[model samples]
Target: MERLSLTLALGDYEHTRDLATGQVPVQGVSLNVLTLAPEEAFFRFTFFREWEVSEMSMGKYVSLRSQEDKGITAIPVFPSRVFRQSMIYVREGGKIDRPEQLKGKRIGIPEWAQTAVIYSRGYLTHQAKVPLGSVEWVQAGVNQAGRVEKVKPKLPEGVRLRPEPQHSLNDMLLAGDIDAVLSARPPRGFGSGIRRLFPDYEAVEAAYFRETGIFPIMHVIVIKTDVLERHPWLAMSFYKAFEEAKRRSVERLSDITASHAPLAWLAPYTERMKNLFGEDFWPYGLEKNRTTLQAFVDFAFEQGVCHRRLELEELFPKQVLTSFKV
Candidate 1:
């Protein structure tokens, strides 16, 4: 029997860093691990940017998405914690009390970010009950000032919409051009910027329609269907390995934290990660997190991120799911 090779795509996140640094172990695997881009995981046998054509060329790819694109199997790799996306942030000295104060504040975010646009429109305006059209949205990217548009669902009548600006968001926020940012969790590198801008920073759950609908989906790991068919034992082995890794990850949380410093949202991040992983954070296939992943996929379809609702069974490795338990 030939040794297997698994190619993975990871994001620029801390947990991924832990995986790369060997702070976390894969456990019980001897396959060659190759790192690929966030998007190119689907293309096969493209080792180190070298393209090889074959039926099993791509091997197995695990990346981030609310769900896998059509024809691929997406396993819930990790449970993601939701955070705030706002326009104005108050530093050491500011008078902003709650969401209501956000009225008339200028906000900056990615124009095409579905999460930001949808959540702001649905959750913030409808649930928070902020004045309609109160947020002055400005479009900004890393290069060149951009344009803004209204993405919120329902707004109060007769509010004046300002001209969205073009500027780098961090630059604008630091320069006092934008009042807050409506985005996902701030990454570690940006932690200092967040602390400097909002020294009184706190993670507030946005008002969302959890009562009747699904929450937003962030990322999932997708496997090809054929791969599952060919390597029956591999899926179970991977799942078991990941489940153990997740367990180890939680058990050694203290060590992980000690090794990594200045993690402002450490407590909450760990708690959420633990919740998602449950007994294990790195479970490969069948974990309770699959339920949450299904809900997310359904919601993504409803919210238009995914074109249609994907069946959990169809999205996961069926062979592995039927056999694995944690």
Candidate 2:
């Protein structure tokens, strides 16, 4: 067997860095996965970029932006473990214990983030029965609060929107500026802040689709469509490897948890991911996720975030997904 050169987009978290950089040899497979945020993925995808990368990112937005482009393939894997806990953050100094108490309070979230803005908000409105418009939204960023691509049509009314570009939600929360901050995972070092807010704060189990009846999109692994055409077997091999990685990650979580002690919050998150990505959450390629994500595209289109709807074949490489499904 020949070793194929592959590039994966690794995130900035310490554990991911450890997986990407510190350990070169893992169970006989070596990946030169580069780390970058969603904003940087597009620039990194350029073929001539200095970074040696075969695959880059195609975030959920790609379903809208890359509708016609055909050179690359993207697979939406489980989001970086950090994202799993984003937006589900601690509410400090408030009488808000249950989801209902969140009403009329100020909520701080990252700017222009589609995941938390649309999906998380929708979860609160639809399942929790909270009146969406009643809460005030502060978009925290630098110089500018990120833009909301499109508001889902079904979001509850009376939601007041506030734009805060001067500081981050973490800073705002600690300073007593905001009632709650929405984060993917807990901010890097705010366990004390979380402790301050809710001494016994346990995570709230929430899923956008299950709660709101809409497919929520997040991160996934993408391979170039042409790559699959040339090497069909590689697709299955890659899928199987990640599945095993998930399994290895679960069975030996102590090793993973111990090795990546930097991510204290990740301890609980790993179990939820194991449940979702376990059998119910199959990396059976993209089909299962697609069925769910496409509905999101439809919702986005209906909400007017996207001008047009995307067909699965148009957005994804036709060859790979079809084979994976069959």
Candidate 3:
């Protein structure tokens, strides 16, 4: 039988490189992979369904799923996971010296429903004791103007978010129009009178992970529901391929003979991560990531990114939920 032909659009990630380069095959599928930037792939795929399979923001996916949009379904293959403590930026010599000071301050975000902002806001509310309504939120692009939220979020009661399409968050934060900014990418003026809210963010993020067993997930692999309906086996094939690719990347990270990563002391860092998280630190699959996934659903709902709370099962298709054991 001829293999099913499919197209996938996603960011050029180190872990997914093998799959993208065709070193790893998706079981019986002939994948035409388009390695685009995450933003481009997300925008095109979310709005236009540009590809049969793509990487989608968890926040946006949860929002869409909550609204009962059945156009797309996901596998448990997460392409991106990041801790957002380091994503927050504050002005130097500003009143907001600490996370607690974020209360009653103005914060800029690229979008209200942005995955990074959702996780950052969740951290503020749960860890920093700052309520979502405590501060005003300004929305705009990170470095350019006229960016808007792709999804319409039902703002929770007492939440106040204003869109400023005329100016970028980078400019606003530099001009002090916004007290701080929560962004995945650092603003252009990051070092020019701007600094991370947590100067020692690595330690803070590690501690946060320890305190709450939630290593925040940013993006999930999704396929058009119609495509899945026609080819139900595609989900497991994609999941298994992604898992093998990630496993190879992890093995390369642990190699001490020669550095797979450019960073010095990568082996030690990988070991540290292994100690903090288990051997499969960057894990794929439902059970290993349930804590983070469940927390994200709760956060997205509470923050109004999702109109209503969503069960974990609702996010992924049943085919990829479990694999047959040998």
When superposed on Cα atoms, how far off is each prediction in RMSD? 8.1, 6.7, 0.9
lDDT of all predictions: 0.45, 0.50, 0.91
TM-score order of candidates, best first? 3, 2, 1
Model 1 — which ten-residue stretch has the worst lDDT? 52-61
TM-score of 3: 0.98
Q: Between the candidate structures 1 and 3, which one is better when assessed by lDDT?
A: 3
Model 3, 1-326: lDDT tens digits are: 89988999989898999999999999989989998888888888888997799999988898999899989998998889999999999898787778989999999999999999999999999989999999999999999999989899999889999999899999999898999999998999888888998999999999999999999999999999999999898888999899889989888988999988789999889999899998889988899999999888899999988988888888888887887988
Q: Tens digits of per-residue lDDT for model 2 on 247-302? A: 44444444543645556656566667546555443343566666556655554443
Q: Predicted candidate 1: what Cα RMSD to the true structure?
A: 8.1
TM-score of 1: 0.55
Better of 2 and 3 by TM-score: 3
TM-score of each prediction: 0.55, 0.59, 0.98
Q: For residues 1-326, could you state the per-residue lDDT of candidate 1 as single tens digits? A: 54555544544444344444445444433433445543343233323323211111111211112334334554545423333334334332445556566678876555423343444544446456665456676655522355342122222246343434545666666667666655443422244443333333333332232342333444444444466466555555555544455555555454544644476656567677555435443444444445545554443444344433455665555665666248
Whichever of 1 and 3 has more TM-score, that candidate is 3
